[model samples]
Target: MKQLIILTLASLFFTASAAADEALTAEVLKEKSLAMCESKASVLPEGEKAEALAVCQCVAENTNYELILEAKKSGDDSVAKQHMEETLKTCKAEDASIGS
Candidate 1:
Protein backbone atom coordinates (compact mmCIF):
# COMPACT_ATOMS: atom_id res chain seq x y z
CA MET A 1 0.00 0.00 0.00
CA LYS A 2 2.83 2.46 0.86
CA GLN A 3 4.63 1.69 -2.39
CA LEU A 4 1.51 2.26 -4.42
CA ILE A 5 0.91 5.62 -2.74
CA ILE A 6 4.46 6.75 -3.44
CA LEU A 7 4.17 5.81 -7.11
CA THR A 8 0.91 7.70 -7.49
CA LEU A 9 2.34 10.84 -5.90
CA ALA A 10 5.37 10.73 -8.16
CA SER A 11 3.22 10.45 -11.26
CA LEU A 12 1.06 13.39 -10.16
CA PHE A 13 4.10 15.62 -9.54
CA PHE A 14 5.56 14.88 -12.97
CA THR A 15 2.25 15.62 -14.72
CA ALA A 16 1.92 18.94 -12.95
CA SER A 17 5.49 19.93 -13.82
CA ALA A 18 4.86 19.29 -17.53
CA ALA A 19 1.76 21.49 -17.55
CA ALA A 20 3.63 24.33 -15.82
CA ASP A 21 6.47 24.19 -18.32
CA GLU A 22 4.12 24.49 -21.28
CA ALA A 23 2.36 27.47 -19.75
CA LEU A 24 5.68 29.23 -19.01
CA THR A 25 6.86 28.83 -22.61
CA ALA A 26 3.69 30.37 -24.00
CA GLU A 27 3.91 33.34 -21.62
CA VAL A 28 7.55 34.05 -22.48
CA LEU A 29 6.87 34.15 -26.21
CA LYS A 30 4.05 36.64 -25.80
CA GLU A 31 5.95 39.09 -23.56
CA LYS A 32 9.12 39.36 -25.62
CA SER A 33 7.35 39.81 -28.93
CA LEU A 34 4.97 42.41 -27.54
CA ALA A 35 7.78 44.59 -26.19
CA MET A 36 9.47 44.60 -29.58
CA CYS A 37 6.24 45.42 -31.37
CA GLU A 38 5.48 48.31 -29.02
CA SER A 39 8.91 49.74 -29.64
CA LYS A 40 8.46 49.42 -33.39
CA ALA A 41 5.10 51.14 -33.36
CA SER A 42 6.47 54.12 -31.51
CA VAL A 43 9.05 54.68 -34.25
CA LEU A 44 6.89 54.32 -37.38
CA PRO A 45 6.07 57.30 -39.62
CA GLU A 46 2.61 58.83 -39.60
CA GLY A 47 1.93 57.66 -43.16
CA GLU A 48 2.43 54.08 -42.03
CA LYS A 49 -0.14 54.24 -39.26
CA ALA A 50 -2.05 51.19 -40.41
CA GLU A 51 1.05 49.00 -40.47
CA ALA A 52 2.17 50.30 -37.12
CA LEU A 53 -1.19 49.39 -35.62
CA ALA A 54 -0.85 45.92 -37.00
CA VAL A 55 2.50 45.57 -35.29
CA CYS A 56 0.91 46.35 -31.95
CA GLN A 57 -1.81 43.82 -32.56
CA CYS A 58 0.61 41.07 -33.46
CA VAL A 59 2.68 41.78 -30.37
CA ALA A 60 -0.37 41.48 -28.17
CA GLU A 61 -1.30 38.24 -29.84
CA ASN A 62 2.17 36.70 -29.76
CA THR A 63 4.10 38.20 -26.81
CA ASN A 64 5.20 36.59 -23.53
CA TYR A 65 7.08 38.07 -20.54
CA GLU A 66 9.88 35.56 -20.52
CA LEU A 67 10.85 36.15 -24.14
CA ILE A 68 10.88 39.94 -23.64
CA LEU A 69 13.36 39.57 -20.80
CA GLU A 70 15.58 37.42 -22.97
CA ALA A 71 15.50 39.97 -25.81
CA LYS A 72 16.42 42.79 -23.45
CA LYS A 73 19.40 40.84 -22.18
CA SER A 74 20.67 40.13 -25.73
CA GLY A 75 20.61 43.86 -26.70
CA ASP A 76 19.66 43.00 -30.27
CA ASP A 77 17.73 46.09 -31.30
CA SER A 78 17.90 45.52 -35.06
CA VAL A 79 16.67 41.97 -34.84
CA ALA A 80 13.76 43.00 -32.62
CA LYS A 81 12.86 45.85 -34.94
CA GLN A 82 12.90 43.56 -37.96
CA HIS A 83 10.79 41.05 -36.13
CA MET A 84 8.18 43.69 -35.40
CA GLU A 85 8.10 44.77 -39.03
CA GLU A 86 7.57 41.22 -40.24
CA THR A 87 4.88 40.71 -37.63
CA LEU A 88 3.06 43.76 -38.95
CA LYS A 89 3.25 42.43 -42.49
CA THR A 90 1.93 39.06 -41.44
CA CYS A 91 -0.95 40.70 -39.61
CA LYS A 92 -1.91 42.64 -42.74
CA ALA A 93 -1.77 39.51 -44.92
CA GLU A 94 -4.25 37.73 -42.67
CA ASP A 95 -7.45 39.74 -42.99
CA ALA A 96 -9.19 40.30 -39.66
CA SER A 97 -5.92 39.46 -37.96
CA ILE A 98 -5.77 42.92 -36.40
CA GLY A 99 -8.06 45.76 -35.30
CA SER A 100 -10.52 43.29 -33.92
Candidate 2:
Protein backbone atom coordinates (compact mmCIF):
# COMPACT_ATOMS: atom_id res chain seq x y z
CA MET A 1 0.00 0.00 0.00
CA LYS A 2 2.82 2.41 0.83
CA GLN A 3 4.50 1.62 -2.49
CA LEU A 4 1.29 2.27 -4.39
CA ILE A 5 0.84 5.63 -2.69
CA ILE A 6 4.37 6.61 -3.54
CA LEU A 7 3.84 5.66 -7.15
CA THR A 8 0.63 7.71 -7.35
CA LEU A 9 2.32 10.75 -5.88
CA ALA A 10 5.23 10.45 -8.25
CA SER A 11 2.89 10.11 -11.19
CA LEU A 12 0.99 13.21 -10.20
CA PHE A 13 4.16 15.22 -9.79
CA PHE A 14 5.48 14.29 -13.21
CA THR A 15 2.08 14.90 -14.76
CA ALA A 16 1.98 18.37 -13.35
CA SER A 17 5.48 19.07 -14.61
CA ALA A 18 4.48 17.92 -18.07
CA ALA A 19 1.43 20.17 -18.02
CA ALA A 20 3.57 23.12 -17.08
CA ASP A 21 5.91 22.43 -19.97
CA GLU A 22 2.98 22.20 -22.34
CA ALA A 23 1.69 25.55 -21.13
CA LEU A 24 4.94 27.26 -22.16
CA THR A 25 4.17 27.17 -25.82
CA ALA A 26 5.64 29.36 -28.56
CA GLU A 27 2.78 31.84 -28.37
CA VAL A 28 3.35 32.26 -24.66
CA LEU A 29 7.05 32.83 -25.26
CA LYS A 30 6.30 35.31 -28.02
CA GLU A 31 3.94 37.25 -25.80
CA LYS A 32 6.52 37.33 -23.07
CA SER A 33 9.19 38.48 -25.53
CA LEU A 34 6.92 41.18 -26.83
CA ALA A 35 6.09 42.36 -23.33
CA MET A 36 9.74 42.61 -22.40
CA CYS A 37 10.50 44.47 -25.60
CA GLU A 38 7.62 46.82 -24.98
CA SER A 39 8.87 47.61 -21.51
CA LYS A 40 12.36 48.38 -22.76
CA ALA A 41 11.11 50.39 -25.71
CA SER A 42 8.85 52.42 -23.47
CA VAL A 43 11.82 54.63 -22.74
CA LEU A 44 12.08 55.58 -26.38
CA PRO A 45 10.23 58.46 -27.97
CA GLU A 46 6.52 57.81 -28.61
CA GLY A 47 7.06 58.02 -32.33
CA GLU A 48 9.39 54.99 -32.27
CA LYS A 49 6.91 52.65 -30.60
CA ALA A 50 5.79 51.15 -33.90
CA GLU A 51 9.34 50.45 -35.02
CA ALA A 52 10.13 48.93 -31.67
CA LEU A 53 7.12 46.66 -31.94
CA ALA A 54 8.16 45.63 -35.41
CA VAL A 55 11.61 44.75 -34.18
CA CYS A 56 10.13 42.81 -31.27
CA GLN A 57 7.83 40.87 -33.55
CA CYS A 58 10.70 40.01 -35.85
CA VAL A 59 12.80 38.73 -32.95
CA ALA A 60 9.93 36.69 -31.57
CA GLU A 61 9.22 35.11 -34.93
CA ASN A 62 12.82 34.42 -35.89
CA THR A 63 14.08 33.03 -32.62
CA ASN A 64 14.59 29.29 -32.37
CA TYR A 65 12.49 28.62 -29.30
CA GLU A 66 13.57 25.00 -29.26
CA LEU A 67 16.98 26.26 -28.29
CA ILE A 68 15.45 28.33 -25.53
CA LEU A 69 13.43 25.35 -24.31
CA GLU A 70 16.50 23.18 -24.30
CA ALA A 71 18.29 25.81 -22.31
CA LYS A 72 15.42 25.96 -19.85
CA LYS A 73 15.33 22.20 -19.39
CA SER A 74 19.10 21.93 -19.10
CA GLY A 75 19.63 25.08 -17.05
CA ASP A 76 22.13 26.58 -19.52
CA ASP A 77 20.94 29.54 -21.54
CA SER A 78 24.17 31.27 -22.38
CA VAL A 79 24.27 30.15 -25.99
CA ALA A 80 20.56 30.22 -26.51
CA LYS A 81 20.45 33.69 -25.03
CA GLN A 82 23.20 34.78 -27.36
CA HIS A 83 21.13 33.52 -30.25
CA MET A 84 18.20 35.59 -29.04
CA GLU A 85 20.37 38.69 -28.90
CA GLU A 86 21.65 38.00 -32.36
CA THR A 87 18.09 37.78 -33.52
CA LEU A 88 17.37 41.11 -31.95
CA LYS A 89 20.31 42.70 -33.73
CA THR A 90 19.29 41.22 -37.02
CA CYS A 91 15.74 42.36 -36.59
CA LYS A 92 16.80 45.87 -35.72
CA ALA A 93 19.11 46.06 -38.70
CA GLU A 94 16.46 44.74 -41.03
CA ASP A 95 13.76 47.10 -39.88
CA ALA A 96 15.58 50.35 -40.65
CA SER A 97 12.59 52.25 -39.30
CA ILE A 98 14.06 53.51 -36.07
CA GLY A 99 17.39 55.21 -35.32
CA SER A 100 17.63 57.84 -38.02
Candidate 3:
Protein backbone atom coordinates (compact mmCIF):
# COMPACT_ATOMS: atom_id res chain seq x y z
CA MET A 1 0.00 0.00 0.00
CA LYS A 2 2.80 2.38 0.74
CA GLN A 3 4.57 1.60 -2.49
CA LEU A 4 1.30 2.04 -4.34
CA ILE A 5 0.82 5.42 -2.78
CA ILE A 6 4.35 6.44 -3.65
CA LEU A 7 3.89 5.35 -7.22
CA THR A 8 0.55 7.14 -7.30
CA LEU A 9 2.12 10.36 -6.09
CA ALA A 10 4.85 9.97 -8.66
CA SER A 11 2.16 9.55 -11.31
CA LEU A 12 0.56 12.82 -10.25
CA PHE A 13 3.86 14.59 -10.92
CA PHE A 14 4.47 13.24 -14.44
CA THR A 15 2.82 11.16 -17.10
CA ALA A 16 4.58 8.54 -19.17
CA SER A 17 6.79 9.79 -21.91
CA ALA A 18 5.74 9.65 -25.52
CA ALA A 19 8.12 9.92 -28.48
CA ALA A 20 7.33 13.59 -28.69
CA ASP A 21 10.02 15.89 -27.29
CA GLU A 22 7.74 18.59 -26.05
CA ALA A 23 5.85 16.17 -23.88
CA LEU A 24 9.07 15.20 -22.09
CA THR A 25 9.90 17.85 -19.59
CA ALA A 26 12.79 17.58 -17.12
CA GLU A 27 10.37 16.66 -14.33
CA VAL A 28 8.76 14.02 -16.51
CA LEU A 29 12.09 12.60 -17.54
CA LYS A 30 13.24 12.39 -13.94
CA GLU A 31 10.12 10.46 -12.99
CA LYS A 32 10.48 8.12 -15.94
CA SER A 33 14.09 7.49 -15.05
CA LEU A 34 13.15 6.88 -11.45
CA ALA A 35 10.41 4.46 -12.43
CA MET A 36 12.80 2.48 -14.57
CA CYS A 37 15.50 2.47 -11.93
CA GLU A 38 13.28 1.44 -9.06
CA SER A 39 10.69 -0.75 -10.76
CA LYS A 40 11.35 -3.34 -8.05
CA ALA A 41 11.66 -1.09 -5.03
CA SER A 42 9.75 1.45 -3.02
CA VAL A 43 10.33 5.20 -3.05
CA LEU A 44 9.74 8.10 -0.70
CA PRO A 45 6.96 10.65 -1.22
CA GLU A 46 9.48 12.82 -3.03
CA GLY A 47 9.77 9.92 -5.52
CA GLU A 48 13.27 8.82 -4.47
CA LYS A 49 16.11 9.20 -2.03
CA ALA A 50 17.76 12.58 -2.15
CA GLU A 51 20.82 11.21 -3.92
CA ALA A 52 18.88 9.26 -6.54
CA LEU A 53 16.52 12.13 -7.15
CA ALA A 54 19.51 14.40 -7.51
CA VAL A 55 20.99 12.07 -10.13
CA CYS A 56 17.74 11.83 -12.05
CA GLN A 57 17.35 15.57 -11.77
CA CYS A 58 20.81 16.04 -13.19
CA VAL A 59 20.12 13.55 -15.96
CA ALA A 60 16.84 15.30 -16.75
CA GLU A 61 18.55 18.65 -16.87
CA ASN A 62 20.74 17.46 -19.71
CA THR A 63 19.70 18.71 -23.14
CA ASN A 64 20.02 15.17 -24.50
CA TYR A 65 17.32 13.63 -22.35
CA GLU A 66 15.45 12.64 -25.50
CA LEU A 67 18.56 10.96 -26.78
CA ILE A 68 18.83 8.87 -23.66
CA LEU A 69 15.18 7.90 -24.00
CA GLU A 70 15.73 7.11 -27.66
CA ALA A 71 18.75 4.97 -26.88
CA LYS A 72 16.87 3.01 -24.25
CA LYS A 73 14.03 2.45 -26.70
CA SER A 74 16.46 1.14 -29.26
CA GLY A 75 18.15 -1.25 -26.84
CA ASP A 76 21.27 0.83 -27.10
CA ASP A 77 21.63 1.22 -23.36
CA SER A 78 25.21 2.39 -23.72
CA VAL A 79 24.03 5.57 -25.30
CA ALA A 80 22.01 6.42 -22.27
CA LYS A 81 25.23 7.35 -20.56
CA GLN A 82 26.58 9.51 -23.30
CA HIS A 83 25.45 12.71 -21.67
CA MET A 84 25.14 11.49 -18.11
CA GLU A 85 28.45 9.87 -17.29
CA GLU A 86 29.49 12.63 -14.99
CA THR A 87 26.19 12.76 -13.18
CA LEU A 88 26.17 8.99 -12.86
CA LYS A 89 29.65 8.92 -11.43
CA THR A 90 28.91 11.70 -9.01
CA CYS A 91 25.61 10.24 -7.94
CA LYS A 92 26.95 6.73 -7.70
CA ALA A 93 29.63 8.02 -5.39
CA GLU A 94 26.79 9.15 -3.19
CA ASP A 95 25.08 5.77 -3.52
CA ALA A 96 22.14 6.95 -5.56
CA SER A 97 19.79 4.16 -6.65
CA ILE A 98 19.72 5.26 -10.30
CA GLY A 99 23.49 5.56 -10.24
CA SER A 100 23.90 2.04 -9.01
Summing lDDT over every window of 10 consecutive residues in candidate 3, give the lowest-scoring window: 8-17
Candidate 3 Cα outliers beyond 4 Å, as residue runs: 1-22, 41-80, 96-100
**TM-score of each candidate structure, all chains considered together:** 0.36, 0.59, 0.35
lDDT of 3 by residue, 1-100 (tens): 2343234334422332353435565466665655644542334455544544454444344435556556655767565544456544544455545355
Error of 2 at 7 (Å): 43
For the record, the alpha-carbon RMSD of candidate 1 to the native fold, in angstroms, is 18.9
lDDT of every predicted structure (CA atoms): 0.44, 0.57, 0.47
**Poorest 10 consecutive residues of model 2 by lDDT?**
1-10
Q: In candidate 2, how many Å is residue 33 off?
A: 2.9
Give per-residue lDDT, candidate 2, residue 86.
Answer: 77
lDDT of 2 by residue, 1-100 (tens): 2222223223322332343477666556656655555565666666766666666667767877666666656756476657666776787678865555
Give the higher-lDDT candidate: 1 or 3. 3
lDDT of 1 by residue, 39-99 (tens): 5555556666455545455445743333333443465544444544454445545635534
Q: After superposition, how far is residue 46 of candidate 3 from its true place, in Å?
A: 22
- The candidate scoring highest on lDDT is 2
The better-scoring model by lDDT among 1 and 2 is: 2
Screening candidate 3 with a backbone cut-off below 3 angstroms (N, C-alpha, C), the clashing residue pairs are none
